[model samples]
Target: MAQQVRGVVARRKGEPVSIETVVVPDPGPGEAVVRVQACGVCHTDLHYREGGINDDFPFLLGHEAAGIVEEVGEGVEDVAPGDFVILNWRAVCGRCRACLRGRPWYCFDTHNARQKMTLTDGTELTPALGIGAFAEKTLVAAGQCTKVNPAVAPQVAGLLGCGVMAGLGAALNTADVRRGDSVAVIGVGGVGGAAVMGARLAAAATVVAVDVDDRKLAQAEKLGATHTVNSRTTDAVRAIRDLTGGFGADVVIEAVGRPETYEQAFYARDLAGTVVLVGVPTPEMELKLPLLDVFGRGGALKSSWYGDCLPSRDFPVLIDLHLQGRLDLGAFVSETIGLGDVEEAFATMRRGDVLRSVVLF
Candidate 1:
C-alpha cells in the first residue's frame, strides 16, 4: 500500500518550500523504505530550493538524514526492517570503473530508487541528492542505507549523511592529514568546522581556521582549531604562513569554494604540501591561476567528492566515535526544529549563526 506523508517540497525556483503531501510507494526490487527520524538542514537543500542545483522543479528537499528501515524489497540482505541507518547519497555500483579499481568512493555510477515518489496530483518529484528525506518516510536503494550503532541520537548520527562526512573525509581521507602536521581550513562553516575536527582526529599539531565571521571562528576553536584568522581583516595566506612558522601549513583545505579562496589555499601551503578543495563551486565560476604556480607547486591538488567516503565503512566508525565521546558530533547540531521551520532554518543558515538546524521528525 502507498503512504501519504508530509514532506518539505520546493515547487518552483526561488520560492519558499512547503510541507506537501508526498505519496511513497512500497519498496520495490532492490529498494527499501525508511522512516526518517531526523534530517539536517544543509546549504545544499537551500541551493536546490533556489534552483541552483538544477531545473528539476518540485524537488523533495533534505538529504542529510538518519532513519529506521520500515520495509525492504526482495533480495535486500544488507539492511533489514527495523534497522537504524544513515542515508547516503552515494550507493556505489561494483561494476563502475572506479569501483572495479577498488575505489568505490570515486564510483562513477551510484544507485538510487528506480521508482519515483510523487505529489498528490501525481506530479513526479525529484529527490534532492536522489534521497529526498525531509518526509516522514523516504524510499531509496537498499545500498543507500548504511547501518550504524542505534544508541546515538538521530540528530547527531544523521549528519554523517552529508556535510559533516564531507568535511571529515576532506581532511582525514583526501588530504591524509598526519600527526604533527600543520593544517588550515577556509570558511569555518559546517564543512570547514568538520575539517577542523577531522584534523584534530588525525592528530594534526596545528589547525588554523580561516573565516570572515568571529562566531564561526569561535565555534571552530571549540572544534579543535589551534588558531583562527579572520580573512576580512587579515591576509589569510600570510596569516596561515605566520602560524605555521613561515613555511605555510602542510595541508590547506579550501571549504569556501571561491576563486580567491582557492588562490589563498594554493599559496598558503608549504612546499610539496597538499591542497584539498572540498568546497562546492557554482557552474558559472571559473578558476584562473598562474601556469607557473600550477607547475611550481609540487604537491597534489585534489577535489573531495563526498569526502571520498565509503558510507558503509565510514558511517559506523564515525557513529561509534561519536558515541564514545571521541568525536563531538553533538557540537554540530546547533538546534532541532520541526519540519515547518525549514524556511526559517534557511535564514539562520544564511546568517551563519548555526552550524546545523536539524529537522526532527
Candidate 2:
C-alpha cells in the first residue's frame, strides 16, 4: 500500500519550505522504499527552494540522506529490507557507455524511481537531485541504495551521500592528491573543509585553507589544514605561493563557484598541477580567463561532479574508514534538527552559522 508521510516542500520560488503530506508509493520493479533516518540540509536544497535549479516548483527538498531499506521491489537485487544504506542521486545504468568502458563513476545515465512522489492533492513533486529524502520514507531506484556498515550513526553516515563526498572525492578521486603533495583548498565551507581532510588523509605535506571567513578557516584547520589564509585581506594566489615556498600548491581545489575564486585557483597551483572545481555556481555566472595563460599553464582543469564517486564502490569503504577512526565524518554535522526546522536550517546555512544542520526522523 502507498504511504503518506510528512515531507519538506518548496511550493514556489523564494518562498520558505513547508511541511506537507507526501504520498510515497510502495516499491515497484527496480525500486526500493527507504525509511530515512537522517537527512542533511544542503545549499543545493536552498537553490531548489529559490528556483535556482529550474522552473520546477513544489520540489521535495533534502537529498543527502541515510536510511534503512524497508522494502525492495521485484527485480531489485542490490538491496533488501533491513539493510542500512546511504541514499544517493546517482544510480548508474549498467548499459551506459561509461559503464561499458568500466568507468561507471562517469555514468551518463543515472536514474531514480520510475514512480513520482506527489502531494496529498495528487500534484507531482520534483525531488531535489532526483532523491526526495526529507520525508520519513522515500522511494528510490535500487541502485541508489548503497549499503554500508550499520554501526555508524545515521547523522554521520548521511553526509557521505552529498557535500562531504563531493569535497573528499574532489581531492582524493578527482585531483588524485598524493602523499607529499601540497594542496590548497579555496572557500573552506563544508566542501572545502572536506577537501582539506581528504588531502590530509592522503598524507599531503601541506594543506593550506583559503577563505573569506575566519571561522570557516579555523574549522578548516581543525579538519587538518596546515595553514589558513583570509583571502579577503590577502592576495590568495600570492599567499598560497608564499606558503608553498614561492612555487604554489601542487593541487588547488576551488569549493567556491564564483569566477574570482576560480581564477585564484587557476593561479594558485604549481605548473602542471591540477585544479579541481567542486563548487556549485549560478547558471548565469560566466568565467573569462586569458587564453595565453591556459596555454602557458600546462595542467589539467577539471570539474568534479559528485566528487567522481561511484556510490556502490565508495560508500562502504568511506564508512569503514570512518568506523576505523581514520576519517572524521562526525565533525561535519554541526547540529541536528527535526523535520520542521528545515526552513530555519536554510537560514543558518545562508549565514554560514553551521557546517550542516541535519534533519533527524
Go through the candidates in order and give each one's C-alpha lDDT.
Answer: 0.96, 0.95
Q: How accurate locally is residue 92 in candidate 2, as Cα lDDT from 0 to 100?
A: 96
Off by over 4 Å in 2: none
Candidate 1: tens digits of C-alpha lDDT, residues 1-361 = 9999999999999999999999999999999999999999999999999989999899999999999999999889999999999999999998989899998999999989999999999999999999999999999999999999999999999999999999999999999999999999999999999999999999999999999999999999999999999999999999999999999999999999999999999999999999999999998889999898888878989999899999999999999998889999999999999999999999999998899999999
Q: Roughly what TM-score does model 1 have, to 2 decimal places?
A: 0.99
Give candidate 2's total backbone clashes.
0
**How high is the lDDT of residue 125 in model 2?**
92
RMSD after CA superposition, every candidate: 0.6, 0.7
Model 2 Cα lDDT, one tens digit per residue, 64-172: 9999999999998878899999999999999999999999999999999999999988999998998999999999899999999999999999998899999999999
Error of 1 at 25 (Å): 0.5
Please report how far candidate 2 places residue 251 from its true position, in Å. Answer: 0.3
Clash list (residue pairs), candidate 2 = none
Per-residue error for 301 in candidate 2, Å, reads 0.6
